[model samples]
Target: MQIKDFMIDQSLKELTEHRTVVLPIACYETTINENIHGYIPLHWHDELQFVLVRKGEASFQINEDKITVREGEGLFINSGCLHMAKDKNNNSGCVYICLNVSPSFVLSQELYTTFVNPYIQATNISYLHLVSKEFWANNILDSIMKVNQLIIENQPYFEIDISIHLTLIWKNLIMNGVQLEHEQKEMLKNKRMKQMLNWLHTHYAEKILLDDIARAGGLSRSECCRYFKRILKKTPLNYLTDYRIQKSLLLLQQPESNVTDVAYQVGFNSTSYFIDKFRKSMNMTPLVYKKYKNSHSPFVNNST
Candidate 1:
C-alpha cells in the first residue's frame, strides 16, 4: 500500500488558496479514470465537504476510518479532517458531485455554532456516511444531487437554491449526530499528523532524510517510522517513494518532457533507477504510458 503525508520536512498541498474562499459554496463534478490520477491524495481544508456519488463507487477515508459509497449514496466530511479517496472497484469510471461549503455561510452565528461548528469540530463525528437505507442520509444525498444539477445547468439564482439545499442537509446532520467525548492526547496526535504531512508535502522535491521527517512530526526517528507504519501501513520512506512516483505520473503525460527530465524534476537522481521504479509501480514504462494517454484521451474527439 502506498502511504503519503504532506512531506518529510514540508507540506503536500499544491493550491493557491489555503482555504476555499472564492465563494461560500463551490461545486465540482469529478469523473474518475486511470489517466486522471485515480486516487485523491490526503489533505484537509477548513470547508465542510459533501460528495454525492452519482455513478459507480468510491471509498472515502477519514483519518483511520474507511467507508465505501456507491451510486445514489454520499458522504459528509467535517472541516480540517484528514481524508482521501479511491475507486472501490478497480479501473471503473465513477462520477461524483463535490461541494465545499464554508461552515458559517448563509447561517447566523448562533445557528452555525449550534448546528454546524459543533459537528465539524467534534471528535465524535469525523464524517457522516450517507447510505440509501437510512432516512436522513437518503434525503441528504437527494439534496446534494439537486445542488449539482443546478450548478451544471447554471440557472439564474442557482446560488440561492444551492444554499437552501445545503441548509436541509445541515439540519439533518445536526439532528442525527451524537457527540462523543474526546481525549486530549488524540487531539494532539491529530494536530501533529497534519503538521508533519504539511511539512513533507512542501519539501518532497529536495534531498531529505528520516531525522527531518521525524522532527516535522515532533517525534524521534524510530517513533516516526512506527507512527507511519501504525497508521498508513508503510514506513515513512516507502510513503515518500510512492508520492514521488505519483508525481512522476502527471509529468509523464506531457510528451515534450522525456523520462529523465520528469524523474529529476521529482527528486529522483538516477534516470535508470527512476525507470525501474516507475515500471514497478505503474506496470508500464513512462514512454508507453504517455503514448497510451495521448491515444486514449477523452478530450481528443471534440465532435461528441
Candidate 2:
C-alpha cells in the first residue's frame, strides 16, 4: 500500500504528449485476497478513474469519507483526489475493473463546450463520488462494462466509443446534483486546504501542532477547524492520524524496520499506542502488515 509519488511536471508532460488520435487508456481487472489484498492505500493520480464493482463489496476511502459500494454499483473518482479501496467482506472478496484516463484525453474544445466547462462551473467537488443504486448508476456501469469488454476485445474505435460513453456518464453526473455556486466556493476552499496539506506532508514526521498548521494557513485554530471540516469533513487531528498511518506504511515495507522502530520513526511515542492506532486505521496490526508485504514479494531479512 505504498503511496505513489506524484511528479507534477512529469505527469503533465505525459498528459500533454499523449496523442488523442488513439488515447491509450489503461484498463485492468484484478482479484483481491489476503496476500493481494486489493487495497490501494491512499494515493492520488492525475488520471480520472472509473471503477465498477462487478462482484462483492468495496469500502472506498475518498479523502475523509468512507463509502461502501456494493455489487451492481460503480464509482468515479476524479483527478487529484486521495482515494483507496479495499474489500471488508469476509466470505467473498471483490472484483472490479479500473479504467484510468488522462483528463487531457477528453479535454478537447468540443468536450469543454459540452461537459468540462459545465463541470468546472458547477461543482467545486474535486472528486465525484457516484452512489449508483438507481437506473442512472446502472446505465453508467453498463456502459463502463461494455467499454472494458470492447477494449479487451480490441474492436475498432474502442477508445472513441469508450470516450463517448464516458461523456454521457459525465453528463448524467452533472445533471444529478452538481451546482455552480457551491462548486466555486468549494474549489476556493479546497485550494487553501491543499496548501495546508502540502505543508503537513513536508513536516508530518516532525513535531507539528494544530497551531502550526493554522498559522501556516493564515487562519486561527477555530477558523482552521471550521474550514477543514467544511472541505475535508474531518478534524485536523483525525487527518493527522490518517496521514501518520499512511507514512508508517512505507516504513513497514522495509525489512530492516521493526514495528517499534516504525512507530517511533512516524512520531508515535509508545509501541502499544502505535499498534492501537495502526489497527484502528488499517484493520491490521503492524506485524501483519509486514507479513503481508513479505508474503507478496521476495523477503530480504533486515533485523535491527
Best by lDDT: 1
List the RMSD of every prediction in angstroms: 4.8, 5.4
Top candidate on TM-score is 1
User: How much RMSD separates candidate 1 from the native structure?
Assistant: 4.8
Which ranges in model 1 have alpha carbons more than 4 Å from their true place?
1-10, 13-23, 294-304
Tens-digit per-residue lDDT, 164-185, candidate 2: 8767766676666656454555
TM values, all candidates: 0.85, 0.72
Clashing residue pairs for model 2: 122-179, 123-183, 124-183
Clashes of 2: 3
lDDT (10s digit) by residue, model 1, range 188-272: 8778777767777777788879998899989999988877776666898888877888888778877577888998888888888
Cα TM-score of candidate 1: 0.85
